[model samples]
Target: MALPEGKMDVNLSNTAVVLTDPQNDFLREDGVAWKLVEESVKENNTIENLEKLLKAAKAQKMKCFISPHYYYPYDHDWKFAAPLEEMMHSGGMYDRKGPLTMEEFRESGADFLNVLKPYIEDGETVIASPHKIYGPENNDLILQLRKHGIQRVILAGMSANLCLESHMREFLEQGFEVAVVTDATAAAKLPDMDAYAAAMINFRMIANAMWTTEEAIEKIASS
Candidate 1:
C-alpha cells in the first residue's frame, strides 16, 4: 500500500528505523516462545518480511536502531510473571538460572543475535530496552533516538498489540512522526492475532502513517 499523500514525506536523511524487540525471545520460528505465538508470527510473516526490510534499510544507508527486551529477576512486576509462567508451562518460555547478561544471551540458544548478525557486524546501533514497560522510565529508546536527531521512525517488531502499540503511542505523544510497518510485528500468543490487527487498525487512525515495507522503502527512497 502507498503512504498517504497529504502527510509529510519521510526525510530519509534524518530518519531512523526503530526495531523493537525483534529478538529470538520473540520473532524466530525456532525461538523459545515461538510455539505459543506461532500463529501470530506465522500469519504476519514477520520474520521473512522484516528481514527483507532490514536488509533494504541497511543497503540504503539509513540509520538503524534495534531495541531488544530484557528483564531483571525480582523486579516486582508480578503481573508480567503470571502470563510468563503460563507461556513457560505451554513450552513458550525459557529462563537462564543466573543473572541477565549480554554475554550469556550471545552464547545462549536465542536466535536473534544470529538473525541480526549482519546488522551488528556492520556497526548498526543496538539499543537494549526494558521489557513490558512504556515511556522514559522503561528505557532510553526515545532519548537515544532524539540524541541522534531522528525526526521520523519506522517501527517494526514483536507483540504488536502490546509493546509495539505502547511504543507507537509514546512516540506520537512525544511528537515524532511514527510509521508502523504493518507486516513486521506479531502478538505473543496465537489468540492475540485479532487483537494485534485491531491495535494496528487503531494505530492507523492516530499514527502519522501505517505502511507496508515496500511503501515505506519507496517513501524513503524518494526522500
Candidate 2:
C-alpha cells in the first residue's frame, strides 16, 4: 500500500533520525528488559531493520539523534513512580545505580549493539543527553535537534508503546514533522497486554506517516 504523499518526500537536510532507547538494556539478550520484548523483536526483525535505517540515514548524510533512557541514583527518589517507572527501578532496567559510576552503562549489555556501534560512534551522530525519564522534555534532545536545524524526525527504537510513542507525541507537539519506522521498533508483551499492537493503533492515528524500514530507506534514497 502507498503511504501518504508529502510525508515521504522528506527533506533529509532538515530531518533527523530520533532513535529512542536503542541501548542494550532494551535490545540485547542479557539486558534487563530483553525478556519482555525479545519475542517481539525477533518476530518483527527489529534489530536488522533498525540497522538498515541507521546505516541508510548515515549514508544520506542526515543528522541523527539518540534519545537514550537512563536511570540515576537520584531517579530512585522520585516522589511518584508510574507503574512502568516502578518496574524500571525494581528490575534494574537502565539503572546506573550510582551517580558517579557509569560502569554498568558502559558494560556489555548496556552499550549500543555491536552492529550499530559504527553509526552511533561516528562522532557525527548526536547522542542527545540521556532522557532522565521517558521523553525529550527531561532531556536535551529537542535543543540538539533544533540546533542542527532539524524540522522533521524519523523515529524508531525499543519498547514501541512506551519510549517510542512518548518521543513521537512530544516531537509532534513540539512542531516537528514525525514519521515512525514501524519495522525498526518492537514492544514488550506482558501477560495481558500487547504493547506493539497498542502502539500501532496510536501510530496510525497520530503520526504523520508510518513506514517500514525498507520504505524509509527508499524514500531517503530518492530524497
Candidate 3:
C-alpha cells in the first residue's frame, strides 16, 4: 500500500533547510548519546548525507537554519521534564556553560558536528536560540524563518523521534511547508523499541512531504 505523499515544488527564493540538533552529541562517534543511536546513524549514512544537504544548500545559496539543543546549569535544576528530557539532563547530553558564553560551548559536545561546522559557521546560516527541550516552541526559529521570508522548509538532522519530530510538528502548526529528508536523519535503536520505525510513521503522517538525501539534493540543484 502507498501512503498519500505530499510533495513540494522547491522554489529557490523561499525554501530553506531547517536542521535540528546537528551537534556533536548526536552525530559524533564519541558523543554522549553515541552509544544509543550509533546503529541507526550508521545505517542511514546520516553524517555524510547531512553534509550533502548542507553543501547543496550552500551551493544554491538557499537559506539554511540551525535549531540546536543545549542545556545550561539552571535548566538541570528544573523540577519536571519528559522521560527523554530526564535522560538528557541526567547524562549531560548537551551541556553548555551559558547562553552568552562560548567558553564551554566551543568544541564541546554541544557544538555543531565537525563536518557541519564550516557550513554552520560560514556567517550565512541562521543559528537560532537553543531550544530548551524537544521542540521549537521555546526558541526564535519561527521568527527567524519569517524574517528570512522562508515558507518551504527542508527539514533534516539528528535523532528522528525526538527533536527532529518535535520541530516538524511545530513548524506545521506555524503554517510552514516542511519536507523531511529520511536518510539525513536517524533515531535510537532501543531494545524492542525502534525509534526510527516510529518516527518514519509520524513523519509520513505529519510532514508536508518526505525525501531522501539524494532526492533533496536533486530538488535543491534544480531549484
Q: Pick the candidate with the highest TM-score.
A: 3
My TM-score estimates for the predictions, one after another, are 0.80, 0.92, 0.97
Task: Please identify which of the two predictions, 1 or 2, would achieve the higher TM-score against the true structure.
Answer: 2
- The TM-score that candidate 2 achieves is 0.92
User: What are the runs in model 2 whose C-alpha is more than 4 Å off?
Assistant: 1-6, 97-101
**Per-residue lDDT of candidate 3, residues 1-223 (tens digit):** 8878689879988999989999888888878889889999999999999999999999999999999999999998998898888888888889998887889677788999988999999999999998987899999999999998999999999889998999999999999999999999999997889999999999998899999999999999999
- Score candidate 1 by TM-score against the native: 0.80
RMSD of each: 3.9, 2.4, 1.0
Our tally of clashes for model 1 stands at 0
Off by over 4 Å in 1: 1-8, 76-100, 107-113, 132-137, 188-193
lDDT of 1 by residue, 65-155 (tens): 8665554444433555566455543442333333445556663433364666677457566565554443333677777888889888888
Most accurate candidate by lDDT: 3
Point out where model 3 deviates above 4 Å: none
Ranking by lDDT: 3, 2, 1
Worst 10 residues of 3 by lDDT: 99-108
C-alpha root-mean-square deviation, candidate 3: 1.0
